[model samples]
Target: MPRSLPPLNAVKAFECAGRHQSLSAAAAELGVTHGAISRQVKILEDWLGTGLFIREGRGIELTVDGRQFLKEATKLLDGLALAAERLSGGPKSRVLRINAPQTFTMRWLIPRLSAFSVAHPGIEVRLSASIEPIDKITGHFDLAIRRGAMGADSTPFLSETCVPVASPDLLKTTPVSRVTDLTAHTLLHAESVADLWQRWLDLAGYRKLQGKAQLRFEPLYHSLQAAIDGAGIAMGPSALVATDIMAGRLVALFPDLPLPLDDFHFFVPPGAATRHVRVFQRWLLDMGLAQSPRPP
Candidate 1:
């Protein structure tokens, strides 16, 4: 018996739009115009005799039926892609696009990305950096990493702990032996994590404490570099500065007073579970577990 099916093109359009929750994003993904995606979705809706989308002001949302259908459609598409790859015999070489914060990219992921390359020579990583919040970042990416409260679909990979760090020369010139000692030394600030210093200070029972001076920089990496140059003490996230601390470039001050910050999370888009993406995700989790003190 032949199993009746919806038009695959229409189904693909609906599935993409449903996953992204936006027609424009779906059109971008499918290399079609917005009107084309709208027409295809309407075709699918008409063919099925149901309303798959409810139009809101300047946007659309999946109907209950559409939401339900999208799950099966996504799975079906993923299975089909996998079957095609298997039928072709072996995995295909591809690029995996990843977006992360500028400082984390420069100080952390870039240094560790070579291991992934060695493990999977066929898949190349296309990395991009941003200082904007994850939701505000506009671009196409297979995966994205952000340091904050975990979202529902995000996987927490690394824990962040904040501590004060300074160059050896700075310590010699203006020592920070305790919480109150910061009052005598300059403090370095990063625009991205501007609250870190205040948060740590409050936790250390010095809510009103003020440093002698302050130096502010954007993207975090600059402030850390400034700290290394003996300009001031910077609040260092443990994961980002472990290498510098280990290499004697920056010294961790009051190691026992580390302030816990949000964990880093990686988010994968719906229907993006290709073999290469899965492999890279696993490799990332493994790396995080191995390097991060946080338990799996």
Candidate 2:
């Protein structure tokens, strides 16, 4: 709503000229003549009441005002291009909304989303962060990956094991030469299941951690991060945390294993299953099996 305005073609000319810092170069890129580029810049300068370009031989350079406008103009055109591409790409994906705890989102699923996207390019997977357990029946989620018991009718995709892990740095400085030594250091607790740490401790026959205040975490993934950062040791679902543990980011606290908990299940809602969901289910379970750690 100012006094005057110039054509968009002039702004395009200014942005190209600023980027290449040459009118002849801008003309080459825009597939126009040097005279056309110069005329456009003149129109822009007339509108803004500024000297935008400097004549130097057969080329040109942007003035301070042209440089400033070029920054904003380039951004607008780039955004417009992206919008056009997405809109022209066709119908939006029918999203497969998923709900998972924040820790899992950060430490696990978020990292693997790129692989999932590569495997399933057509379907969009939307993740919702929820600490509370999700009920797939009434909810909009197509599937859920959760650490709880599931009925035979449920648990569609995969089942995974649990394993104990800590950082190598923790072992070097601390006096953790044996299983009994764990009693001295702080142990991470998945407080959601009051007996999770206690059970793992018992299975490994480690007694020192018996009454110590275990560092409680609502989500197991948080405890895993703490363990990796050398905060404390946490037992985690091996299927989920295996990649990191195997990569040596977090070390397996014990070589002796415990029974894998078949409790955690990936479930798709009954009657809502589709060909795409079935394909995703197969790929995920295969990936989990492929990711299992070697025995000591």
Give a tens-digit lDDT track for model 2, residues 90-186. 5345577776666656766788889888766767888877645455334667666666644333342335556567888887777565776776677
lDDT of 1 by residue, 1-296 (tens): 99889899999889878865778756655667889999999999999999999999868888899989998987888788778886998677788999888899999999998978887787989999874666676447888888874345566778879899999888888777778898888899999889999998888888899999999997799999999999999999999999999999999998888899888877766556555775676677677777785651
Whole-model lDDT, model 1 = 0.83
lDDT of 1 at 187: 92
lDDT of 1 at 149: 42
Q: Which number leads on TM-score?
A: 1
RMSD of 1: 8.2
TM-score on alpha carbons, each prediction: 0.69, 0.60
Ten-residue segment with the worst summed lDDT in candidate 2?
A: 149-158
